[model samples]
Target: MTIIRSRDFTGGRPWAALDIASMNGIGTRLHWTDQPYIWHINEGQEVFVVLGGRVRMRYRKDGVEQAVVLAVGDIFYAEIGCEHLAEPLGEARVLVVEAVGSL
Candidate 1:
């Protein structure tokens, strides 16, 4: 468990971008529109830092479902095998760190 500042990790527009597999993996665009975007279960644990706009996350944790709406600087964790989904709120950005293919 670590605490990282959102400003220090982002895409440089409003925040940084990180790959779920590579810590240095930044800005890959999670936006999935114009088609059917299916949010899947996380293969492993994951974390993220909200940058611009808002991040809406829907996932399963501890036998229950959870929905998290995070604003700038907000932090989140996605447990392993937990089905999760995320999307930006009106052109939002975030710094995400997690397994190679968690969500």
Candidate 2:
């Protein structure tokens, strides 16, 4: 068994992650980032959880753009083909669970 403190975790680069588990081809990761992620769509569904700090999440739906500010313990669910981006308010730690190799 491995125990990790999400707030204490550090990554090599923005969205850099440590693989935590993979079951039935779904993967879970712990990540750290201080920069905004590129807008893109995931081939599969994703569960984004904020473990530390804050994030401004932006997404587009039905040709309309929307955004939400997420703080610690907040979660964002991204459906397949949903275009989205995440901009961190500062150094933040996040947990992302999605299909392996999904962007």
Candidate 3:
């Protein structure tokens, strides 16, 4: 059993992560970042949960770009093939669940 204090979590570099679990080809991880993630579509669904700090969730729908500011406790769901990116407003901690090796 493990108890993680999300507010206190950090990593060595931007977008660094601590892998939490993997099962049936799915993966869960805790990530710390102070920069934006690349815009790309995932091979599978993704669940992004903000554990601390803030983020600007960016995405495109029907070729139209859209975004929203996400704060602690906010959740972003990315369906497979959805083009998206996560730009951290500052040093932020997030929990992500998706398929292993997905981009």
User: Which runs of model 1 end up more than 4 angstroms from their true locations?
Assistant: 1-37, 62-64, 101-103
- Put down candidate 1 lDDT per residue, 1-103, tens digits, no spaces: 5455433443443322343334553223332121122577656666666665677777777768788788877887766676777666655666556555434
Q: What local lDDT does model 3 show for residue 66?
A: 99
How do the candidates rank by TM-score, highest first? Answer: 2, 3, 1
Instruction: Tell me the alpha-carbon RMSD of every candidate.
Output: 7.0, 0.7, 0.8
Poorest stretch of ten by lDDT in candidate 2: 5-14
- TM-score to native of every candidate shown: 0.57, 0.97, 0.96
Report the number of backbone clashes for model 2.
Answer: 0
After aligning candidate 3 to the native by TM-score, how far in Å is the CA of 10 from where it should be? 1.3
Candidate 1 residue 99 C-alpha distance from true site, Å: 2.7
Q: Count of backbone clashes for each model?
A: 8, 0, 0
Error of 1 at 41 (Å): 1.6
In model 1, what is the error at residue 70, expressed in angstroms?
A: 0.3
